[model samples]
Target: MYDFNSINDYLNTKIIGQTIIQYDNLTSTYAKDKNIFNTCPDGTVVLSENQSKCTVRFGNKWICREDKNIYLSIILKPIGKNLMISKFDVIGCSSVCEAVADTCNVECKIKWPNDVMINNNKISSVSCDFVGKSDDPSGVIISMVVNANMGTDEIDKINEEIKNSSTSLKIETGTDVHRELIIGHILNNVEKHYDEFMKQGTIISAVSSCIHNSAIVNKTISVMKRGKKTVRKLYAKSIDGEGRLVVADEKENEEILSPGETIIIYEGKA
Candidate 1:
């Protein structure tokens, strides 16, 4: 259980975690109970011990171990902020990387846009969902799931591809980590980076951070092309200036896809 009273003891933030709502279970923290955004203040966090039906990009099931990980969604009302929704992706991804590195003392890599990888296995993930229409939006939900303390037995339940690519802090470090402490650090980090982003109003810092710790660049990986169901093998060349991925296919055809254009996952041995 996340002790609400003690969470503030670890927090050192101005926003992005001023309020947190905890639940024992939910379908998914992003949509099901997201009505809280209407009333709650900005940067409110909706946390759950377990999600009965949690899905990642393209409806892929996220095997959430009850009470064994950090499953939370941050609600942000950016409509009044006069900011682009895509900017939150930068804050979310970079914040997670910084927090994990600080808390776990392990090198973390960003898989394309936002997923965090440790030694090639996914140890954490950040999913940023924009509310309302594409051109116009009201809010954004940054859902994150960090594999904090799950062991090998718990991770084995996942099927082959995911099982092989997923990992946890406990499994990698051979120790149990305090979940609340990680969440607290993440909240504080997000706020700090977010304020910097607002002050500068630029995302090049984020682009540099991702490129510096890229996981897919210089590696062969599978990317489900935009508006297509089938995944393709592509050699990711690098991330461009605007944070778009520059990848090349079998025929040496190069294509650039923005962060929202496609989903990148490890399908085969790279």
Candidate 2:
């Protein structure tokens, strides 16, 4: 397992007094573990190298890739209103995409709710779980898992199974990258965005500007409903005050979607 000190030391130079923890493996989901530390402090991060079997299962496949990606969860205890937990998923993906874009110069676009894609391929997948009392909904535990190791061969195999639906950094950048460094950059960016959201009210002007400057806006998208076989064409109307995708249909009717529902933004017109 990597040293927690090293992770903290690296982050300290970028962010002051950010608390972090490391684990060899975890038996529970990142959300479950984060809740255990919910009341701790802000910027408290818990990282595990390997996770239990149950934690790896996502639908039909195991989300764990062992040494291939950064498996991390963070607890960001923000004050004020309990912002929509769903928006954090967008914040997380946009942060990762910005970090990866800076490092690799690959055009990264966020696929609706929580996947990041580069050159029409998927480079990262993000998930978040929220735990807090209704009376005081400010406490939130957000966890994200990113795939940094999916290279050409892995992408080819995955594409064969799923058919042009997924991608990785190695395929777009044509080079191997360090998962830890990417994780650190992603965390930094996420912290910056989260801070901005807290300070600025969630009006369309403020939130849309942040998301547009990041790479999720103006992309043609397809929304994949949970348990459905087909994907639908939808334009990203705007990221809501809470960060959910406010997408529109061919008729320009808008719909607010939950983060758990699968969404894929196509690189080309659907």
Candidate 3:
């Protein structure tokens, strides 16, 4: 469980979560994004020990068992003209990768757009919500899930379909990790890079960090589009300044993708 006092004491961010609303359980952290957007301060954070209906990109349910992972959502007001809200996904992913590495001593990688991978399997998922009427929103919600103390046995019990595709910090490090440390490190890293993004108005640092820490780029992979059956096989060339994936198909045609599933193929074989 996350100790509110310990987390608050350890948090080093300037404004990422000065005001936090924490619960032992909830339907979902971001589920209250609309309810609090009107009065919540810029860095208000909503955290829960468990979520009954946690969701991810494309409306998929995220597994949120108690005391097993990091589940929280942060509220932020849009800053700078060049600050694309989309870049926060990269920021979150990079921050998690760094935090996990720092705390667990196991290297993790980002899988384009947002998923964080450990040993070629997913260990974390990042999602964002902007509930305003227009493209420019008054507030933003950044939600994240990290598989922490959920041991290998627990992970093995997940839906058989994705059971083998996901992992946890305990599974990676063979030890029970302190959740508060992970959360504190993530908040600190997010604050550090977020300030840089707000100042530069671009994701240059985020793109570089993600590209360096990513495992999917430069690898032949399969891309599954949302609500569609068609899939594309491409080489993930890089993550552009705007956070779009730059990829090239077999025909040498270059294209950028958004909102798609990336499956890294094995050595260009299938």
Tens-digit per-residue lDDT, 1-270, candidate 2: 655554554452333127666776776446545556645576667777766642321332334555666677767666765566666776777777778877777777666565676655555666665565655665666566666667656655552544365555666667777666676677777777776666774434325534664444555576687778788887776777777767788998888877666545454521
Pairs with steric clashes in candidate 3: none
The digit string of per-residue lDDT tens for model 1 on 1-270 reads: 777777788899877778888899988888753666678887888888998987765566776888888888887775455555446666677778878888889999988776888887888777777777656777778888889899998889888878988899999888998888888888987777667666665666666777778877888988886778998889999776555788998999999877777777665422
- lDDT tens digits, residue span 1-270, model 3: 579898887799878878888889988888875678888877788888999997787676666779788898888775535545457888888888888999889988887676888887888888876757546667668899998888877877788756867888888898888998888888888888777767766667777889999787888877766556777788889888777778898998998776444433333211
Candidate scoring better on TM-score of 1 and 3: 3
* Decoy 2 TM-score against native: 0.76
> Highest TM-score: which candidate?
3
* Whole-structure CA lDDT of model 1: 0.78
Between candidates 2 and 3, the TM-score winner: 3
TM-score of each: 0.87, 0.76, 0.91
Misplaced by over 4 Å in model 3 are 79-85, 260-270
Clashing residue pairs found in predicted model 1: none
Single out the weakest 10-residue window by summed lDDT for candidate 2: 54-63
